[model samples]
Target: MTIQFYLNGELRREDAVSPTTTVLDYLRVSAGKTGTKEGCAEGDCGACTIVVVRKNGDDEPLYEAVNSCLLILPQLDGANVVTVEGLARDGHFDPVQTAMVESDGTQCGFCTPGFIMALFALRQGNEKITDGTIHDALAGNLCRCTGYRPIVQAAHQACQDATKDLYGELSPLIPGEGYEHNHQKFFAPQNLSQLAEMRTDYPKAMILAGGTDLGLLFSKDRDPLEAIIYTSSVAELGEIEETKDYLEIGAAVTYTRILPYFERLYPSFATLITRIGSRQIRNVGTIGGNIGTASPIGDTLPCLIALDAMLTLYSKTGSRELPLEDFFIEYRKTDLKPGEFIKSIRIPKLKNKQKFRAYKISKRYDQDISSVIGAYRIEIDGLRVKDIRIAFGGMAEIPKRAVACEGAILDKEWVEDTALKAGLAVTTDFKPLSDHRASKDYRLCVAANLFIRLYRDLTDAEDLMEVVAA
Candidate 1:
């Protein structure tokens, strides 16, 4: 197959013979662009961050940062890509590079390229970049030197330069010709039918979207996935639509795109989504990828379950929709049949009287796995609970709804006593196992306390004081 795309203002194409060839490998070896470093081969580290520009129409391009390691070679077809080395022109540093150098941002400079590209994507008009924004922008890039203060300063300084938008005139990078590899072949399907047909024909072929999770197979598990199908070029899988009743999020829609919608609908879940990974991971990681991975500790699952989300699965035969909870079967397993792929996630709009909240407890504030996560949705009529849904992750073999706890809180008034009793009832639903991150007892206690906290906040007694003699 011939992979054709724009590469750093140049139209290029490569003949790709093997499906196992990654975009990172193609960039470093074939294109001789080594600025994109390989930190974790998996998407955990943003050392391989690169900007992908897709033509929206004839005006400005739609730019996004993605992990290069997870992408198959064929996915580069019809797209424009920019790497760290491509930022400068005529042997001169771009504003971002100048700022980083002036600010002494690079220590062990391996991760600098990724950071530069991340901040580059974040730059828009003359907007004032806040400290929080800088922190969030570079969250994916890990500096071993821990010298983030200067790097963050560089990001702020770069935004002030007028030359920041010089790259707007640069030509888009495009892939060229056929690539040769070992035995397997890669396919870049353009339409949904082509993707479905390919999947139907090759059920065992590894489906690659934003390689956030699938990339881990190469680094951590060391699994050899030769036959590959890249979904990045499929236009239909990337659509997002919002109607009066539900929001339909396509399977390939990245977390960065969905964050704003989730924030508008369920504000509480936004915090958890922001901390799912780093900005680079979130930029490339799809909600569908998280659901497809079927990890018990995935931060999004509990929240989605609490919101009563539904998933649409499509195959060559037809499409089927079911509640998100029904998709999980057991540990590291799902109910998806052969040749079927997740199409989109449909979440109903919250009612006026309903409340939704999500809480995540991790060892560190950012870039860490969850020790335990809890998401809740409750409906109240005057002081009595009309309905409630409680879901938890890292507490069982799968992210599950605590039906017993929900039953205990349903029809009950929002009060401390009711919260306490309901919290205790959660014990009947899950007995969390002890792990290095947290003890079983600690998880249980925290799970119960989260309910109590939610109840206090809902009742407007969150800061209640108790009189004591001291």
Candidate 2:
């Protein structure tokens, strides 16, 4: 089969490129689109930023800035891709390029293309062009020379008058076929039944969603696979539904797609997700992958486990439900049966009387791993605690509930003094190890202090626990 996509406005149909070839290498070698530079082979560096124009459910084009180095060729199978070379007409620059040059935004010129493309997407978006928005838009694109004042100024200048985007009127390309090379198959099933059959047929196949972490195997570690199944193509696995009790999120839903829901329902949880990675990372990372990875410090797992979320697994034979807290058996181990795959996650809505909060303590503010993440759900009946659930990451072998701490907080007065007792009770829980992010003692101190922080924020006038500005 052939892998087809619109590259820089022209149609590209390739039958020879391997499934493992990243968009960065493809652009430099095969397509000859070198304008998109490769700064960091990993997704962290925005040096290889590119815009992908794909159709949403309503068939409207949505543009997103993605790291080309981590983006595989198959990911753009049926989409419109715009590189820096696509933004010019005869020698004139796009609005972003024009604004940059006019506003003195370029200095070293090494990271210009990535910044241009990133800002280009910002100009096309409806977000207000301010210092905060501009900083977020260009967070992935780093430049050591120009500083950010001029870039922010250029972004503000360029986005002053919104105009038609380059791909505004263009029709979106549809992914209608799968590809195979070197006898390796990539099954892109369009429906749920096909995905189930494919999963059963190839139980050992590597399941890919967004490819944020999965691509690291090939992009950075040089680990190649034999067979793979792409979950992004399965439409049903991307649908989000809200029922009377639970919010069903498809396993393939990206963080960007789910952040708004979290912000509206659980603001603290949404705040922690924004700290997961930069805009480029969140655009492709999925919550299902976080649970599937089963890392002890996964930013979302502690909150999800504390919220009593459930997972819906599917197989060719049938489907089953498992609690999120029980899914993780141990370090790097999950209770996944053979031929079983996660289809969706059901998160119960927070009750009116329930108070939910999540805290993440990391070394740096952004793009950093958490040393300790605490998620709490407390219910109070006037002065007495009705119920309390506390889960922690980076504080145990798994994303687990603080059973001892919860017991101490249960049936007690919801006051600072009771919080102090609960803090001391967490000493009976698992002993956290010392690491680069924090020491064993530091982790425990932070973990214990978070309980007190939660109490103070709930009882005090200020909401110091709420995360803002990113």
Candidate 3:
């Protein structure tokens, strides 16, 4: 079978390239589109950013900026891709490129292509242009020279004027085609039943969603797989359903698609989501992928656990529902049975008098792994704590709840003294490992101090927590 996609307004049908070939390598080696550079093969750096155009259910075009290094050839099968080379027409540059040149945003020109593509996505988007928006859009792109002043200037000028949708009139391309090359098979299922059948057949195949993490095997480690089951194409897995009781999110739903819901329902969670990665990463990454990784420091795990989320696991025979916390068994492992895949996550809405707050502590503000993340869902009655749930990451083997810490604050008055007592219980909850991001003592100290911070945040004591000049 052949992998078909539109590369720079031209259709590309290929059966020769390996199924594991990354879009970065394909662009540079096979297609000879060297304009998209590769700085870090991993998704951290934005040097290999590319714009992917796909149609939503309403047939409206959504242009997303994603890391090409982490994208496999089959992942772009039915989308329209635009690299830096595609930004010119009739001897004229795109507005973003022109703004970059006018503002002198280029320094050594190595990271220029990535920045231009990232800013190009910003210009095409309908978001209100502001300093914060520009900063959030370019957070993934790094510039060693020619500081951000000129870049910010260019963003203000270029993104202020809205651009017309170029791919709006085009019909949506049908994707979900199985591809095989170099003895490797890739199954892109169109529905959940097909996904279950593929999973039952190729049980050992690596299940790929956004490929934000698994793509590292191909792009960075050069690991070859016998088969892969792509879940992003399954129509059932890309849905977001909201009910009066809860919000159900499909496993294949991307972060960009859920950010709006989060912003409205969980504002603090939304703030933490923005800090997960740049727009490029969020445009493709998914919460289900984060939960599937089962990492101790997965950003969304603690928040979801604190919120009492439930997971629906699917198999060829049937399906079952399990609590989110019970799914994680050990380090880098889960309770998923053979041939079972995550179907969707059901998160109950916050009831009256209950508020949710999440805090992520990392070295750098953006694009950095967490040292310790604390998430809390608390319900208060007068001055007493009615009920509370606290979950922490980077403090144990899996994203686990602080059971001991929660007990300390339960049935107690919501005051500074009670908060301090809970902080002491955190030391006994878990003994974290010392890593490059933070030390064991630092993690413990921070994890405990977060209780006080949360108390200050909920009690409207922000003035007292502020530091005074010596």
Candidate 4:
């Protein structure tokens, strides 16, 4: 089979006999574009970061930063890609490269290319970049040399040059017919029906999306996955729509696109999303992917359960929607059947009278798994709780709803004594196991304390004097 795509502003094609070949291997060995380094084969490190620019229309292009290590070569069949080596124009360094040189950003240079590519996508058309923006833009790239100050300074400087074109106008790098291989085949289906049919035909095929999680199998586990099926090319899986009652997010939608909607509807959830991964990870990872993985410590699960989100699953048989809470059976297991995939997620819009909050406890503030996560949604009728939903993660074999605690809180008066009592009842709901990140006792304590915090914030006490006096 012949796999072709644009590489470094050139049309490149390769012949591979096996579908197991990864884009990282193809680029370094077959295509000889060594600038895209492979630091941690998993998507954790941004050493393999590259920009995948696809045509939305003739006027505007959609650019996203993705980990090259996890991508199968066939996924790039018709898309245009920009690598670190392609950033320059006419033998001149791009503005980002020039700024990095001026700011003394490159020390060891192993991570330089990845950082440059991240900044290149981040600074594409922006006129000014602030410290916070630079920090967020380069969050995925890790510098072991600890030379972050200069690199951040360089990004800021690159943004100041408004007249300079950091990314020049270039044609899409589409592969040609000259390349041929017999053993491997790549399929990119444009619609959901086509994708479903292909999936039904090949149930054992490896499905590739953002590769944030799937990429780890190759890099860390060193497992070879052949018979690859690429999902990014499917248009139906990436749509986002807002209706009168709910927000619908397609499975292929990236975290960057959906974060703003989640922020507007659920502010507390936005904070949790930021901690799920770095900016680059967010750019490539999808909400559906997070739900599909069904990890015990998945940060989004608790919030999704609290929001009463619905998961829509599609297969060759047909389409069905189920509450997200019911989709998980245990750690790393979901209710999805063979040849079936998640289509989209629907979340209800909260009303003004409703109170909602989410909390994540982790050893580090960002780029770490949750030690314990709690999400609460409550409806208050005057001074009493009309209804309540409480969800928790990292407290059991699966992320679960604390129905016992919810039962205790619903219809109860909004008071400190009641909240404290309800918090204790939550401990009886689940027995968390000890892990390296936290202990069973700590998880229970934090879970209860989070509920108390939420109650206090909602009640709005007149003063701290009452607590002090008591």
Highest TM-score scorer: 3
- Give the per-residue lDDT digits (tens) of candidate 3, residues 135-181: 99999998765588888899988887786547423425678568998
TM-score per model over all chains: 0.91, 0.95, 0.97, 0.91
Model 4 global lDDT (CA atoms, 0 to 1) = 0.79
TM-score of 4: 0.91
Off by over 4 Å in 3: 165-171, 461-470
Those runs of model 1 whose alpha carbons end farther than 4 Å from true positions after fitting are: 55-59, 124-128, 162-181, 219-224, 461-470
Better of 2 and 3 by lDDT: 3
Cα error, residue 76 of model 1, in Å, equals 2.3
Can you write out model 2's per-residue Cα lDDT over 52-144, one digit (the tens) per residue? 876655766667898888878888888788988999877877888899999999866468888888998888776777888888888788776
Judged by lDDT, which candidate is best?
Answer: 3
Please give the lDDT score at residue 18 for candidate 4: 45
Q: Rate the local accuracy (lDDT) of all candidates.
A: 0.81, 0.85, 0.90, 0.79
The residue-level lDDT of candidate 2 at 207 comes to 88
> Which tens-of-lDDT digit does each residue in 108-218 have in candidate 4?
657989999888887774424788778777778888767699998899888876664524244444432222245333456677998898789878876667777886776
Clashing pairs in 4: 1-181, 1-182, 6-173
Worst 10 residues of 1 by lDDT: 461-470
